[model samples]
Target: MSFIPVNEPLLNGNEKKYLAECIDTGWISSEGPFIQRFEKEFAESVGRKYAIAVSNGTAALDAAVEALGLAPGDEVILPTFTIISCISQIVRAGLVPVLVDSDPVTWNMDVTQVEAKISPRTKAIMAVHIYGLPIDMAPLLDIARRYGLKVIEDAAEMHGQTYHGRPCGSFGDISIFSFYPNKHITTGEGGMIVTNDDHLASECRSLRNLCFQPHKRFVHERLGWNLRMTNLQAALGVAQLERLPEFVQRKRQMGALYQSGLAGVSGLQLPLASTSYAENIYWVFGVILDASVPFDAEEAMRRLGKMGIGTRPFFWSMHEQPVFQKMGLFCGERHPVSENMSRRGFYVPSGLGLTQEQQETVIDAVRTIMDS
Candidate 1:
């Protein structure tokens, strides 16, 4: 039996054809037609007016922060339960990251906590759509509106999720996506920032290209970084984007199967879908181990890996991480829920191309571990 990995990219003839054309035309580098086409298509699909492709998700965050014109002493609020890359960019952009605990049920930023943390220095709120589940945006938006703050969405894991009939990325002032190899769509390693503001969009493009040559070459402007994505990546992304709807559908099917398979299990708690959203891509199918259960999430993962079923630990809370502690970011504040979830939570295999038998194998392995 082969190991069922967490994610797998599905490609078709279009990707190969475009990649070959790029190679043949000697346009495989940064400047190419595919890159422009991809930016336009991706922006439209996500319901944004503009999209700027970059090297990786982290760079996308940097672009958003820089484009917003965040100043020193500015504070950006984000959930403690998120990838380190989300918080790291705020620090890199010379801003303070105000970390808050997440909602225990949704595993997303707790919107209720936002009001208490609102200070005069608060400039933006970095709302993340965790594990492909869209956050409740109404409250977040209300808070932002009340305080005159911006919203930058970290939508790396969520490609096809919506909130209150609106797309996740479109709710924020600026939103970002990652095309890492394991994501729903892959362009090897790439990212994009989407925004409706023309000025911000142009600023992001300039920031991605070292803030030089808005039109003429060798023209110096504000300092920036070389974070542009290659034409080959965009070629692959265009192919992936064409198949995204099917990919999202298949993920939903597999996720439903996982929920049904573990339905009556005594020692596990399954993730629930949001009532306000119609679609969720299930980027990762996660479960929480009941304390009454005989085994912990880590030990079960180890046992399942031995059974040819690969799994991963949930995101470690940023507040508990040593790097944040060294930087004095939420050092004393204990996010008990986020910390505990990090220990008890683990996600099963959920790839776009995973077969029914492969999913059954994972279900059997997990059941066996619990049954034993």
Candidate 2:
């Protein structure tokens, strides 16, 4: 009867208790106790030695790109199917972003194309895990090793998810995670760069805080942006991080229910349930309408909206973006899989806040629209 949003955060954990402490103690800036605790515990959770918290996921990308110490005009290869944040800092650093396609089934970057994209100037690989599924890391990591390219893993959609018994964020030379509300964990609005390399971690810490140094304050050896994460955000993150396993379990349950309920629906492409190495975390219960259907995702979303269901469209491929096109990027390049996904794919309400009753309503609504 009422509108069900595409996402709503579940914060019935220690979020309130931590926030109260922040308010009572005046430890509200970037240098508070919760910031260190969140960073330390989160780094340990992901099996990394250090974590640097920042303002948002985009900032994490900026720091990851800058910390690599790659020269201008060096190339970074990444999926065209991922969020624009994946390519933003790469382009800003004057690094050429070599585009790659997505796999038809998994909707993740086709790791096969990565090697072909490598050039003499290739300096890094930005592997962004898509939706609820991870990009296959074995081949990519090997390629990076052989070419001596740094790996920047964007594990923004994956929190407790793993790849072949190892954590998603632990694979990269430097990896990043987002703490947006829709993510597996929420810091209201925050991001973190995690890594085993002590020097890289320290570089990220300085980059995040306007390149500030302990020995010298208000003096800069290099230019860095002010992308510091607030203590209030980290306070929420510390509480949210504690409940990640429970949250992950609930998300999977929600997805399983959708899969079973929507099994009979035709002309719809559901996310892959699992791969040999990892089970799908079902980040947002994404679905793509078959091209044979009379309409596209825009029409399907409109139909769902009328039935009180909120939905989100898949990412628009970087190659097709007007901004990039105007700048003469990805000229004459075609990644067919990502292009098709952009037109037909969209996600439903599969947040942790989604209940069985709400899910059932959504499932029935989708089936009804597709059948007619």
Candidate 3:
């Protein structure tokens, strides 16, 4: 009986070969050929005109937010059920964060609630694709268009997903991706910002490099962070990008396996496999404990841990975060759907490298616990 982790990166492709090439050519830093190559190919893949590689997903968000040149009191509408990086960057850029609740079915930002959250000061909408599902982007785009607001698509968990046949990352004014080990692709730690606007692309490039002046290096006109991605990471990213189609197919198969194996299990609500917008890539095989169930995700996770099976809780709603509460932000805000999911939802092993046998073992363990 071996422990099964919640997520693992599949690096069977040219990961090692690319790293070796970087080492052999002594092009391991951010200024190497692979950086440009990765950026170019990734932009093309997502149907964007330009892409800028950055140190990590957080950096990508920071640079993108900064590029917007948002005013101190400008408002940015985002989902309550998203990673803190999404909200933190907005706050850091001197913008106010306004939150919308999640759709009970899709587990994504409920577009219906978005209109009520908008105000005269609203400047942008950050559409975060949750888990493996793309948010219903068409209406969100419509809202943005009507209000003259910018859209920032966080496609970190939705690499290969699409909406109405259009790519997830292609919908935003500026889109971002994370190459964390748990993501569909891995550069160990890397990120990219993609946009169709040439000026914004150039701005992102400058922001990623400590705002270095084109002719006079180090004499910066604007303050920026050194958030450049290394060539070694870009090399790995290029290889991963090449295999994205195959990786997406494999993920779908894995999701199907979990659905079949865990179907009919009592007190468990499985992740949605597909919706009208797009099929779930099943980033992780998440499940929510039914309200009827006596235990919460924490207790269920504890039980799974005792059985040597790894589990992870879902993202806590931004409205409920202690830091935000302390800052007097999102005061009295209640996103019921997100709050419920945060407490009851937990994902089991759903890595791209997960074998059929290991998946079955996880299913069995889950079924056993539910039955008890």
Q: 61 in model 3: Cα distance from truth in Å?
A: 0.7
Candidate 3 minimal-lDDT segment of 10 residues: 87-96
lDDT of 1 by residue, 1-372 (tens): 788897766776389998998999999888999999999999998899999999999899888988899888899999989888888868877799888887877878888998899899999999998886788888899999989999999889888777776777898899999999878888999999999999999999988989888477687867888999999999999999998888888888988899889888878878775456555578989988877976777898998889988899998998888887887777578888788778889998887767899898889888888888
Model 2 TM-score, 2 decimals: 0.99
Name the 10 consecutive residues with the lowest summed lDDT in model 1.
272-281
lDDT (Cα, tens digit) per residue for candidate 2, span 129-196: 99898988998999999999899999999999999989999999999999998999999899999999
Residue 166, model 3, lDDT = 91
Pairs clashing within candidate 1:
none
| TM-scores vs. true structure, each candidate | 0.96, 0.99, 0.99
Which pairs clash in the backbone of model 2? none
lDDT of 3 at 213: 92
For each of the candidates, give the backbone clash count: 0, 0, 0
- Clashing residue pairs found in predicted model 3: none
